[model samples]
Target: MHLPPKQGAAFDPLSEAFARDPYPAYAALRATAQPVYYAPFDIWLLSRYADVQAAALNPLSLRSLDHLMSADEMAEERRAQNWHDMPFHARFVQFSMLNADGEVHQRLRKLVFREFTPGQIERLKTGVATYVGGLFDRLGGPFDFIEDLAAHVPGLAIGRFLGVPDEDCPQLRGWSDDIVQYFDIDRTDARKALAERTTKTFYDYLTDLSKHRRRHPKDDLISRLIARWDTGELSEDEYISTCMLILMAGHGSTIDALGNGLTALLRFPDQRLMLSADRTLMPTAIQEMFRYDAPLPFFHRYASEDMEINGWELPKSTKIGLLYGSANRDPEAFADADTFDITRTPNRHLAFAAGPHFCLGNHLARLNMEAVFSQLLDRYPRIEPVTEPVFKPGLSLRGPKSLPIAVR
Candidate 1:
C-alpha cells in the first residue's frame, strides 16, 4: 500500500511571513507528503513523523552540515564569503563538531557527557530556583520577558553548571549570542564577519581560561574536559570547540523556549489556569510547549548513499532538512496536534531533535522552564501582552526579541 507522497507548496524558510508564523506553511507541507523537495533551500524536507525519525535515528545518515556539500559548493561559498582572509572563521569551520560525526562526535560528546546527565540537571533545579527567584523579585513593572527574564536566567543557570564565575555569566552570554549568528540561515556576509570576529576572540579567551583551569583545576565542566585533554582523550581543538558549542547550544534554545513557552501560556489561558491549579502538570505542560512550537525549526542530515524517502530518490551527499517543527505538529502523529494542551500524555515530540544528536542540554532546559514558569504563575496574577511579540528576523530559530508583558 504505497501511495505516492503528495506534492507540497513552495517553501521559503527565510521569508518574513515564515518567520513570524510558519505553522500554516508547515501544516501544508505535512499534508502533502512525508518528504518534499523544497527547491528554494535546495534540500529535501521531511515533515512526517516517520520520515523525520528515520532520518534522525539512521546511523548511516550524517549529522555534519559539511557533508551536505560537494567540493564545488564549498569552493563557491568560500568565494562568496571571503572566509580565507578570516583565519578564525576558517579555524572555526575546521574544528566545530556540529557537522562532525563518528569518533569525533563521540569523543567530543563523551568528555562532558558524564557531567551533563539528567541527574546533574535535576540537581541544578535548586540553583535554577535560586537564580530565577532573585530575577523575578527584581521585576516590578511591565517588563520585556525575553530580554529581562528569558535571556538572562538561562545564562545564569549555564554559568553555574559550567562553573563560570558568577560575574562572567553575562560575558559568556555575549559570546553565546554572537556565535548563534552562524545558525541564522539568512545572515549576511557582514553579520557573519562580525560573528567570526566575536568567535575568534571568544575562542582565544576560553582557550586561555581552559589552560588556567587545567593548571588550577576547579569543580566545573571545563576542568573535567581539560583533565581528559591532559590524558590525551581529547584534542586541543576538539576541547575548545566543545566548550564553545556547549555554551551556545545550552544557552540559545533555552532562552527561545522560555520566551516561547511563557508566551504560549499567556495565549492559552485555560492551560495556564490548569497548571496553576495543579502544579503536578508542569512537566507535561513544558512538553506541550515543545511540541506545539519547537524553538528551533530544523535539523539537517547528509545522505550517506543513494536513498529513497517518500518516493524521491536522493543521491549521495544530498542535504536533508528534518523539519522538526512541522513533524511535531503532524496530525497523523497526535490527535489535534496543533492545539496547545499541556496535559499531553506520551508527547514524544522531536523538539530536542531525535537520535544521537538529540540535545545534550534538554534536562537542564526542562528544569529551567519548570523553575521559571512555576514561579512566574505565582509572581503575576495575570500577564497581558503590550504588543504582538516581535520574533528575531530568522526562520532557523523562533522566539521573541522582545515580549512586553504587563504583570498585574
Candidate 2:
C-alpha cells in the first residue's frame, strides 16, 4: 500500500514556515497527500482529524514507547552531554507510561487511575478555587498570567495533593521549566546544565520522599505507590517514575492549558463574554480551548508491524507522529475550524489523546481550568489583555510562555 502520487511537491513537516504555523501546511497535506503523509522528518504524519483519532485509538498500529530512543542511544546521549547516570533518568525509557505498552501500560495506568479518580479530583475543586481566589486577590495591575497566575495554581495544587511541602512547590516549578527548556530545539550548554541539575535535584528529593513514605505511610498517591513498591507490585524505580510523571503531567499540561485558554478567551472577547455571562459554558469553553490550542501539539508513536493506513504502507518499526493541534482544527471535523467558539458541540478533541495512553489526569486538568476560570471571572469581572501573548517555541507543546493580563 502506498499513498496516491502527489501532483505537486510533497509536504515537508520540518520547513521553517511549517514550524511557525503548521495548520496551512497540514491543510495542504490533507489536500494533496492521503491521510498519511510521508514527510522528510523520517516519520509519517496523520494530518486529518479522522486519521489522527483512528491512529490514536488503534494501539496495535500505534505504540508510544516504541518511538523513543533505544536504551543504547539514550545512554550515549547522556554520556555525550556529560550528564550524571541517575537511576531515575537512566530508566526513563522503561519507567514512563509513554514508554510502556500492553499489560504493562494497563497496570501502571490502573495504579494512577485509582489515585486520580473523579472523586479525588472533585475533592480537589474547593482547594483549586481557594488558590485561584487568593492568587487573584494578590495580583495588581498587569502581570504575566502564565508565570504569575496560571503556572503557580496547578503547581500549588499538585504539591498539596502529592503532600510535598509548600517550600518545594517553587523548586518543582523550576524543574518543570528547566525540563521544558531542555527540550527546546535550539538547546544550549547552559540550558542543558540547568536541566540536568534540576532533574537531579528532583530525583534526589523524590528518592528521599520515597524512603520517608516507606517508613511513614500516608494517604497520598506517592505513599500508595510506595506501598505497592513494598509489596513487589511495583518496582522501586517505577514508584519514583510514577511520582515524576504525576508532578510533571499534573502541573505542566495544566499550566499550558490555563495560559493558552486564557489567551484564547482574551483574544476572542465575544467568546469570553459568552462564557462569563453563562458559567455553564465554561466546560465547553475548556474543551474548545484544548481543541483550539492544545497543550501538546503532537505526540510520538511507532508502528510495531507493517500496516496499511489510508492507502499508505507503514513499514514495521517506523516512527509516526500525530499532529493533535493540526488535527483539532481539521476543517472536515470542525465547522469554522479557525474560529474560537466556546460553545462548540460534539467537540471530541484528541488533546488528552485516546485509547490506553489517554491522560489519567484529564479530570484534574479540566477541574483546575473550570475552578481557575470561575474564580477569575467572578473576581476580575473586568479582566483584559495587557500584552500580546508569547508562545513558547516548541513543536511538541503549544502554549504561551508569557501572557500578560490586567484585572480591574
- Residues 192-233, candidate 1: write the lDDT tens digits: 777788889888888778767778888778888788888998
What tens-digit string does per-residue lDDT give for candidate 2 at 361-384?
Answer: 888889889988888888777878
Model 2: worst 10 consecutive residues (lDDT sum): 85-94
Best by TM-score: 1
Provide backbone clash counts, one per model. Answer: 1, 0
Which pairs clash in model 2?
Answer: none
Write out the backbone clash pairs for model 1: 64-99
